[model samples]
Target: MRAYADFVVEYKLTVEFPNFQDKIYVRDGEELARWWIAQTNRPDTIFCANDEAAAGFITEIRRAKFSVLGDIAIIGFDNTEVANLLDFTTIHYPVDQQAENAFLILQNMLHSTDKTLIPLEYTLIERHTT
Candidate 1:
């Protein structure tokens, strides 16, 4: 998640994570939202690790009387179908392509085939949020 923090910094945006004062962890969605709102000073953009976290954040934000993608832009990773249905902007990791590449590699290793294999590709799928 440090890398994600660095990404926000590079983009000239502020980020905040839930406090972790101990080894054991918790996922209190409301607490996380409060911390994030306080730390970012209610910034107009938020980035979450996954769609689930983003969904939680959005719920809290809505409960706080804030409009999603209107007052703030929310983005999550892993282009899940739910994210698409929710019109979320996400990182579209090529999972199918990756599996294909892995299968090709394993097949080549298991059998001496002279067939050429194509590499996997990835692209960002833009949506409602920026």
Candidate 2:
């Protein structure tokens, strides 16, 4: 999560919009709302660390009279059930593939003594929340 945030900063997303950092971090939706209320310039796009936070953010923003996806575009990691229910855009973690890889590594270890690296894949599911 920190790496992604660093990437956003390294690529100049934060430089382009300084408010990105503040709007992206909060204890919960209520705190997010408080931050939004205090912001002179509210960010239209937010990238949450997880779907739970994204869902909370969406609920709070709507409560504050902002349209979800229309007024704010939110992206979250971990494409959980809540994210699907809310039709939010999120990064899908391939847990099955990861488990398979781990199993294979154990099998290999039992048969032979060798070190191998396995790569995991992730997908971005685009939905109404963008």
Candidate 3:
């Protein structure tokens, strides 16, 4: 949240969200959409925690007569299959690479005493949604 706030401040962009403890889920999207609808100055875009939330949010947004990447844009993390099906923009987490690196790290640790950090890569998949 601090990073998002910092980005918003740096770019002078407005943001809004409901005060929810757990913001993960396909169901939480409806809750977020309801919050957006209630706002007088509704946001033009939303950054969801994951594809499931984005999917859920879009479901409600469409039900409320809003269009994805038209009336509003959406971006999510994890690059899930749901994101592909929805054609939503998302940040793809390198899960496979991370797991492979972890396995190698553990194997090396068995012989070496030194602990080191492994770097992995991530990418943005720009789809229909921004």
Candidate 4:
């Protein structure tokens, strides 16, 4: 919350949920729904830590009879498959690629072969819900 407050102050944007301390304890579905209602009423954007929390937030927003991106732009971290299926914009972390690279590196080290070098790569996937 403090980080978000700092970001808001640094950007100088009209933050609707400036009272972050008051909305800090919204953990469950009902509390999340209430917070969504308050935020939607003020038309504030929401930033979530991960896809699960974003999924919960979207669920509550939908339950309250409001659209997800229509009412507020929701941003989430971790480019999970759920995010892709829901067309949610998220930061892409190459989990699979990282695992593959790690496996290859381990295999090379175990075999003690230096014939060729393996390359590591990462790319961002862009979808809807920006």
Candidate 5:
């Protein structure tokens, strides 16, 4: 969340925070949909915490007789299988790479006293939803 806010500030981007955040889960997204519909002024884009939540959000949004991109655009993190299945934009966070990096760092730490860590990043996957 801090990185997101810092990027927004650094880039001088205009983004609204409607306080639509919750636990990372499909059910959380489903529940948040109700609050989203209640708002008179809705944002065009919503960044979900994960693909599962985005999937849930899309499901509920469509169930209410609204188009996914037609009504709103969705961007999820962790670009899991659901992202490709749903054909929505998402941030491809490679957990495997991070895990490998961490393991290497740990192995090095065991051998030597120097224990340095590296940072991982996310890649944006452009799709129909965006």
Candidate 6:
């Protein structure tokens, strides 16, 4: 949310954060699809917190006779197996790198007390869903 807020501020874009007051999961995303269709002016794109939610959103939209990346676009995070299977755009989270960093941190901890924190980074894996 903070990252999105920063992006909106930096670009001076008017974006609305609708309070669905529910966890951002597959069910929520499905519900969101219904809400989206009810809107007179629908958003051009949606940024889901995870691929599962995005997949659910895609399924629901397609069921409603809406075309992917045609009626709306979607971007999801945590490029999971579903993301690849669904061919949706997502952020490739560096799980392997994070595990390696953890190991290095532990090895260093045994020798010294210096605590180090690696920066969080992600790669955008573009796919047709975007």
Return the TM-score for each candidate structure: 0.59, 0.67, 0.78, 0.55, 0.76, 0.75
Report, for all candidates in order, the number of backbone clashes.
0, 0, 0, 0, 0, 0
Q: Predict model 3's lDDT versus the native.
A: 0.85
Per-residue lDDT of candidate 4, residues 9-60 (tens digit): 8999775553423332225433555666865355456666666566666677
The list of candidate 1 runs beyond 4 A from truth reads 1-31, 101-119
Each model's lDDT comes to 0.67, 0.75, 0.85, 0.63, 0.83, 0.84
Tens-place lDDT digits, model 5, residues 30-117 = 8767667877888788888888988888888888887888899988888888999989999997798788888878888788756565
lDDT, candidate 2, 1-130, per-residue tens? 5786799878877433333343333356546655765687887787887877788788888778988777779888888898899898999988787888888788888988565646777899999987
* lDDT by residue (tens digit), candidate 3, 6-120: 9989999765655654788988977888888788887798988888999999999999898888889899889999999989999998888788778878877897755554677
Task: For model 6, give the 10-residue run with minimal summed lDDT.
Answer: 15-24
Q: Quick one: ranking by lDDT, best first?
A: 3, 6, 5, 2, 1, 4
Per-residue C-alpha lDDT of model 6 across residues 1-130, encoded as one tens digit per residue:
6777799999999866586544468887788888887888898898887888888888889999999899999988899998899899999978887897898798788878565767779999999977
Per-residue C-alpha lDDT of model 1 across residues 1-130, encoded as one tens digit per residue: 6776788889987545444332111144345566666664566786666666666666787788877877888776678876787777877777777777788888888897755666655556678877
Candidate 4 backbone collisions, by pair: none
| Poorest stretch of ten by lDDT in candidate 2 | 17-26
For model 6, the local distance difference test gives 0.84
Q: Which model is ahead, 3 or 5, in terms of TM-score?
A: 3
Top of the candidates by TM-score: 3
Ranking by TM-score: 3, 5, 6, 2, 1, 4
Q: Give the C-alpha lDDT of model 1.
A: 0.67
Off by over 4 Å in 2: 1-27, 99-112
List the candidate 6 regions with Cα displacement exceeding 4 Å: 2-17, 20-22, 99-112
Q: Residue 122 in candidate 1 has what lDDT? A: 50
Model 3 segments more than 4 A misplaced: 7-17, 100-112
